[model samples]
Target: MAALADAEHRLGRGLPDDLRQLLLECDGIIGHTAVDTVWSVEQIVAQNLLFRTDSSFAQLYMSFDALLFFGDNGGGDQFAFVQTPQRPDIFVWEHETDSRRWVAGDLRDYLGRSLAEGGDAWYQ
Candidate 1:
């Protein structure tokens, strides 16, 4: 709870309720081949900050100010929550094409799909 609160403080916004509950229960979720399907509270804060402020990213891709990144596919693509409109839906930020698209309905749905048989590229 302290970590979550700290994360929220650092990010300047509250995370989704479902995500907060999950993080409180466990530091993070690990999936196939030991990948961090859902990142820990610390990583969540770090990664989001990096994406949002990295100078190179600013030139390479669209502004990340509207997204709250939380996980990665072990490939380069990442998962995030839409912060612009503050929805429960999760979206994938494909690094290659700079495309952002809906993937799961919420954190629960994201876990089911990402941890299933298809390995890390489940969203693909």
Candidate 2:
């Protein structure tokens, strides 16, 4: 837990609200019984499980003001993005990483791309 928090602080990014809430529960900040889903991100990161999805195009949400997705970008190695969920659809470039396969898409790359000049589209 400390490792995860430190990594998040040093990198300055977080999982989607829903995922974070689940983590908080695991951290004893909330009741574990509150969780309804069977898959936990913690387990994924710990290599206890794999992504349970129907397709390779996985949908990931972040607490940060950016939209990120990681998977094969049509071909080659799995690609990563820090994209704007809005018109113009500005996106950030990033590389793939083991941690990103669960939490972030190479935080360094996404952090740079997600910090462009624009208000969050989520509120718009």
Candidate 3:
């Protein structure tokens, strides 16, 4: 939990409380029958940083400064938050189309829907 806080502090902002609690419970989740995994705090920071600097992504989307990536769908698609308000909503970034779509209104909803659907693939 301290590690998560440290990562958030380094990023200069806090994660949504639901996400913080989720991370505290488990560093990340491995899909029941899928290869996808939500990233740990460290992994999230690293992945966000990597994407933030990618030249191609920058050319297309300006910047990832307002986003915080949390997971990936094993096939290259990413799950993230838009970083607004008290509870950040979930969005999925499709690798093939280079587009993003809202998945859930909040972390709890995302988890429930993702689990109910069996895995992250349902969103794809």
Ordered list by lDDT, greatest first: 1, 3, 2
Cα RMSD to native, each candidate?
Answer: 0.8, 13.9, 2.1
Candidates 1 and 3 compared: the better one by lDDT is: 1
Two-way TM-score contest, 1 vs 3, winner: 1
- Please report, in order, the local distance difference test score of every candidate based on alpha carbons: 0.92, 0.32, 0.78
Q: Write the per-residue lDDT of candidate 2 for residues 12-99, one digit (tens) a residue.
A: 4544443345455663221123321122334323321123232343444223234323222222222223433322222322224223
Local lDDT at 4 for model 2: 53
- After superposition, the stretches of candidate 3 with alpha carbons farther than 4 Å from their true spots are 60-62, 85-87, 117-119
TM-score of each: 0.97, 0.24, 0.84
Question: Which regions of candidate 1 fall more than 4 Å away from where they truly are?
Answer: none
Q: Over the stretch 57-100, how does candidate 3's per-residue lDDT look in tens digits?
A: 78877467777889877888888888754446898888777787
- Which of the predicted structures, 1 or 2, would earn the higher lDDT when compared with the native? 1
Ranked candidates, highest TM-score first: 1, 3, 2
Model 1: how far is 84 from its true place, Å?
1.1
